[model samples]
Target: MIKITGEHHFAIDRTLFVFALDSEAGKVFNEKNKLVTGIGKVNAAMELTQEIQRNRPELIVNLGSAGSRSFGKGEVVCCTKFIQRDMDVRGLGFEKYETPLSGIPPVLEYGLLKEGLPQGICGTGDSFEMNHAETDYNIVDMEAYPLALIAMKKNIPFLCLKYISDDAGSEAAEDWAVQVHLASEAFNKILF
Candidate 1:
């Protein structure tokens, strides 16, 4: 009973426990069929919790693609902690996109680079980054934040499996499309 949620559907390598998201990127599926109305990352956690409350799963895995601020492509970094890098609250002079809490969760861990693949901490954002000049985070992506926040609210044990598709401050911008397949393939090899 593994359900997956992310922005893209075709990028995942294996489909054994997959629950494919639709165009708006939301759905519920068993091993046999799917049921999708209209949902996205913001509501995904509650949706999954409700679904799992009715029938609990062993665990939930949040799998997707991301942009790296400094790391190179083909790297498979796991997020020990993910901050909403786009959360704007600087009017009071507080740091924008600061971590919600002080310390990392004990359960929020990973076996990074276990397969001899490059891996590192993932810093999530709500935009596509083409360079790492201003941002000091390791990776950037849109959906991982909401997914992590929601999952935390539900007290669900989860893992973020991301592949670096774009390097924020390099020529990798043009190479993103060409490297996506390689990244996905790398993620598949490491995750499964």
Candidate 2:
């Protein structure tokens, strides 16, 4: 178990783990951290909500593999901002990535950064990105936005660390399969 003391010297008691796949979760699996994994955005959101309601951990950490056009494979990054890339409502007069009628801002910020890890904005969606989008986001994942949004809504501290598994190219799936263990190992280094 990792113990992180806050500004007030209060140690975080528990941290919830949210991952999109078993391969990613297996790499960082431990008996101490409570883990919940699902395939896509909806499943991840639902599972995370349920987990938070049931466990109510002091912090929520979403760790997993991501495809990045800006970073090299196996590079780990800490995400301080999250945006939903598939939420396009431009025709309805809202911004392309805006969440319609949601009082919360479309962009969610999780402001925790480790000293040596690169910081980035994670773009989340249901589909795996094969072509790069014309956005400023540096990393792409399937579940970070929903996980971050739920953590924000629940008033829980959120942190996301992503390992670049692929470049969002045609080989993304295969690359992710092979590189997930590496990401997990890297995450282990950060946690301990």
Candidate 3:
């Protein structure tokens, strides 16, 4: 269910825009359809589920800051695939990223792709990635995997847009602190 469309054709009213923090989305969006779902996967899933129970949104859109090594700072990327970076079950005779008994694959490969944006395979986990080692995903974040799964289970449209706030390995914390606030400037151009 991946499709790409330009911002001019996007319907903001029917979309529920989600963020990990208010600071990430506060500058551009209002309270109408915005949801700030704390940080981790549990919080993201829980909050999004609660909101869905309250009112069914036509689309679930996740907009947040992410760390990337390949992409430059201030770049807005469209993430169509999500993987649980922390799910290590190799000790249990399962694959490294595979969930122990879950039917879902390691990567959740369904999302709405926005036009004119570079695509990314996002790795979602609880910890902020300072220097990510070997991994299949190019983008690192804390919430997108669960959000994409929830949207998939509910059969709602989902879109994930990430602003590159820091270089994953290179002085990430300091760079993220200075760059996270500027995320909205990049997102506003594409999403507003």
Best by lDDT: 3
Q: TM-scores for all candidates?
A: 0.61, 0.90, 0.93
For residue 141, give model 3's deviation from the true position in Å: 0.4
Deviating ranges (above 4 Å) for candidate 3: 1-10
The top-ranked prediction according to TM-score is: 3
Clashing residue pairs found in predicted model 1: 130-168, 131-168, 131-169, 132-169
lDDT of 2: 0.79
Per-residue CA lDDT of model 3 for 1-192, tens digit only, reads: 123473424456778889999989856787448899999999999999999999888888899999998889999999989889999989879877788888888777988878889999999999988987755999999999999999999999898999999988869999989898988777777765
- Per residue, candidate 2 scores C-alpha lDDT tens digits across 105-152 of 667786466557888899998988877654658899988998888787
Whole-model lDDT values for every prediction: 0.49, 0.79, 0.87
Decide which is better by TM-score, 1 or 3.
3
Give the better candidate number (1 or 3) by lDDT: 3
Worst 10 residues of 1 by lDDT: 11-20
- List of clashing residue pairs for candidate 3: none
